[model samples]
Target: MPGETVQPTPPGPAPVPVPGTLVVDTSRGDRLGEFRGAAGPYWSLRAVCGGVEWEAEPGAVRRATRKERLHAEIERWNARSRGEVL
Candidate 1:
């Protein structure tokens, strides 16, 4: 133990952004905030849905759906809008 070097503990995982809180995107990454317009474009408000807490981007966010049905819907909409039969 006399000559042994005790290495310092490495930093832990970053904190989870709190729900209902805004965060700023610093060069070091996200930090908590109570209001918007104080953060950069890469930053966003934190939220929780379906029992999971996560950061959300601006605008509409929806639950993930099956790919086949999702693609089919898109195709149907495109066809209808183009006046083509589906």
Candidate 2:
């Protein structure tokens, strides 16, 4: 271990705040959430339907086009239902 280099663990997901546009994730059967800032090292998002909130790691906030975002959101919803968090 003396010569080994330890890399710091990466941070949690951050919200990519897109103001004023309502995003619907049909795959999840629910609407995509709104950005509500960070909670500790995790980024928080508030799903409009039923007011459900969730946090994701920072890697999730990578810049994406509108179409990419929508596709990602749909995939996210599907993943969530399958007990997988992206």
> Best-fitting candidate, measured by lDDT?
2
Worst 10 residues of 2 by lDDT: 20-29
Tens-digit per-residue lDDT, 38-59, candidate 2: 6787656665333566665555
Candidate lDDT (C-alpha), each: 0.39, 0.56
Which TM-score value belongs to model 2? Answer: 0.36
List ranges where model 1 is wrong by over 4 Å.
28-86
Please give the RMSD of candidate 1 to the true structure.
Answer: 13.7
Error of 1 at 82 (Å): 44
lDDT of 1 by residue, 12-76 (tens): 53444444343332322432222222143323433211122334443222222355335545655
Error of 2 at 33 (Å): 2.3
Error of 1 at 37 (Å): 17
For each candidate in turn, give its C-alpha RMSD to the true structure in angstroms.
Answer: 13.7, 11.2
Model 2 whole-model lDDT (C-alpha atoms): 0.56
Point to the candidate with the largest TM-score.
Answer: 2
